[model samples]
Target chain A: MQLAIVVNEGPYTHQASDTAYHFTKAALEKGHGITRVFFYHDGVNNGTRLTVPPQDDRNLQKLWSELGEKHGLDMVVCIAAAQRRGILDADEARRHGKDASNIAAGFRISGLGQLIEAGIEADRLVVFGD
Target chain B: MAQKKKFLYLNRKAPHGTIYALESLEVVLIGAAFEQDVSLAFLDDGVFQLMAGQDTTAAGMKNFSRTFKALGDYDVRKFYVERESLAERGLTVEDLMPITYEDENEDYAEKPSIHLVGRAELAAIIADQDVVLSF
Candidate 1:
C-alpha cells in the first residue's frame, strides 16, 4: 500500500516524530511505498540542521535525513509552519533577508497542498502527533 | 477527474492557548480547493471552537472563531460535534454559533451545518472516511 505520513510534533520535546520515524522505517522495510512525509506544527523543527543532542542520545534530525535519503522519500516541511518557527531553506533565507538557512538535507519546504495531494493519492495517510 | 475522497479534520483541543486549532483551519481552507468531501469533527475541548461570542481582546490573540462561519462558503458543510464531548464540557448545541450554508440543490435554501452526533455514530462516520486528519 502507498502511505503518507504527517508528523506534528518536534523532536525531544515529544515522542511523536520519533514514533513516526520508526513507523516509516518499518513500513519501508515491509516494501510498502511511502508517498510523502509531511511536517507541520512543531514537527517542522525536525528539518532544521541546528539541533545538537547529548553525545549518548539519539539524533532524530539526522535519523530522518538519512532515512529520507536512503528511501528517496518525499520529506516536506510545511513552509507556513516552517517560517513561523524559523526553519528556513537557503532560498527562503535569502528572500526574507536572513543571514543563514538551517533546513537539513533530504527535506524540502513546501505548501500544505502537498499534504492534501498526498491524502488524495496515497491509500492511507497516517498522522503522528500530540 | 479524480474521485473525491472523504477527508475528516479531527479537532481535539481548545480554541486558544495553542496553535493546533488555528493551524488545522488553515489546512481545511487549503484542502477545500481540492474539492474533496470534507468534514470537521469537534470533540473533547474542540467543541469550544464553535462557541458563540468568542472575545479575544484580553487574550490578544486573533479571534479566529469567525473563520468557521466562512467555511460554509468553501463548500465545507459538514461539522460533526460529538454529543458526549459537549455534555462533558457542560455545553449544548445552543451554546455554539449558528453556522449555515446555502444549499444549491434545494433552491439555495439556508441550512444549518452543525450535526450533533453521539460517540458511536461518530465512530461510524470516521470509519466511512478515506482520510482522517487529527489536530
Candidate 2:
C-alpha cells in the first residue's frame, strides 16, 4: 500500500512531526510504500537544512533525509507555506533574495496539486497536526 | 473515460481556533460547486470535530461545527471517524453528531462513506486517495 503522510506541525514543538516520521517508518516496516511526505503549515520547517539543534539531540532534518534516501520517500514542502516561513530551497532563496536557504536534501517545494495527487495516488493519506 | 474528481478533505484543526476549518469548507464547497465528489475524514485531534454539541458562540466564533451538518447540503455526505482515535479518547459514533456513512464498505466509493479502521488499515486510506490536503 502506498501512503501519503502529511505533517502540519513544526519540528520544535508538537508531536505531529515526530508522529509523521514514526508513522512513515512503521509503514515501511509493515511493508507499506510511502508515496510522499507532504509538509504544510509550520511542518515546512522540517525541510529547513539550516536548523541547528543541540549536539545532544537528534537532528530531525537529517533523519528525514535518511528516510527519504533509504525508502525513496518524497518529502515535499508546501511552496507557499515554505516561502512564507522562510524555508527556501536554493532557487527560491535566490528568487527571494534571501541570504541563506536551508532546505534539506531530498525535500522539494511543491504545490497544492501535489496534495491532491497524493490523495489520488496513495492508498492511504494520513495527516498529523497540532 | 471522464470522471468526477474524488476529493478528500483532511481537516487537522479544531473549529473556531483558526480559519482552517472555514477555509477548508470553502474549498470543498468550490469543488462540489464544480461537480466533483467530496469526502471528509478526521484524524488525531481532528476527530474532536465529530464530537457532539460544540458551543463556540460564546467564544465569539461562528458556530463552525454547526456547519458540518450543512456539508450534506453541499453534497458532502461522507463524514468519517478514525476508529482508533475514538477508542483512544473513549468515544464512539454514538458520541458524535448523527453523520451518515456506509460502515460496511471498506473500499473507496463515489458516494460519501465512512471508514472505521485501525492504524494498519489507515495506511490504505492514504494510499488510495487521489488528492490529500491537510488544513
Name the lDDT value of residue B54 in candidate 2. 84
If scored against the real structure, what TM-score would every candidate get?
0.99, 0.60
Predictions in order: lDDT: 0.98, 0.75
Q: Which stretches in model 1 have alpha-carbon errors above 4 Å?
A: none
- Candidate 2 residue-wise lDDT, B20-98, digit = tens: 6765665565555554567687877777777788888678877766667666666677765678888888888777876
The residue ranges of model 2 lying beyond 4 angstroms of the native Cα positions read: B1-6, B10-36, B39-134
What fraction of the genuine interface contacts, i.e. the true contacts, does candidate 1 reproduce? 0.86
TM-score for chain A, prediction 1? 0.99
TM-score of chain B of each: 0.98, 0.78
Model 1's lDDT to the true fold?
0.98
Reference-based lDDT, residue A22, model 2: 86
TM score of chain A per candidate:
0.99, 0.95
**Best by TM-score, which number?**
1
> Please, what are the lDDT tens digits per residue for candidate 2 over residues A50-126?
88999998788898999999988888997877887888888988988889878899999987556656665677778
